[model samples]
Target: MSLEQDVATARQALEALDRACASVTKHVGETVDARRLRGDLSRVRDDLDLMAGQQSYSAYEPFAGVYGDGDDEGFGGAGRTGR
Candidate 1:
């Protein structure tokens, strides 16, 4: 696959990661026990933020694969193949 496609996939992953972080933050605010997720959330947020930094148009190394295997049941919960 082309580097452009990899970069695009990484960008999409970064966006989804950001949305997940926001959701976690909202949940934390609504819960009384923020300490429970303090560590996990911090790590995940940092990882996502770091991953986003590698999506540059001129980035050399390819980003980690974002697409799942062809047998991924996550596509539509019906074991859909590649999209």
Candidate 2:
């Protein structure tokens, strides 16, 4: 998969883990291991946020609208319909 998809998947998994951790805390009480897990999750989430902040848009959709619609006469039929 693409980097964007991979990151999104990681984020979803992290969120699920976070929720599960909370649920476990309710039953097991606040244990040292649980606290450590929570801290680790927070650090991972921060890393993901930093990665997103530095994401290069050009790396995702390399040619999303580069050719435009083939309705016009411009290169790739882009024309100037909306210009």
Clashes of each: 0, 0
Q: For model 2, how does the per-residue alpha-carbon lDDT over 1-83 read when each residue is reduced to its tens digit?
A: 88778889999999999998899988878899888988889778777766767644334565558745526465555334554
In order, what is each prediction's RMSD in angstroms? 14.1, 13.5
Error of 1 at 10 (Å): 0.6
Q: Give candidate 1 misplaced runs (Cα > 4 Å).
A: 30-83
* Residue pairs with backbone atoms closer than 3 Å in model 1 (clashes): none
Model 1 residue 68 lDDT? Answer: 45
Per-model lDDT: 0.57, 0.77
Q: What digit string (tens of lDDT, one per residue) describes model 1 on residues 3-27? A: 6566577668766866776677785
Best by TM-score: 2
TM-scores, all models, native as reference: 0.35, 0.54
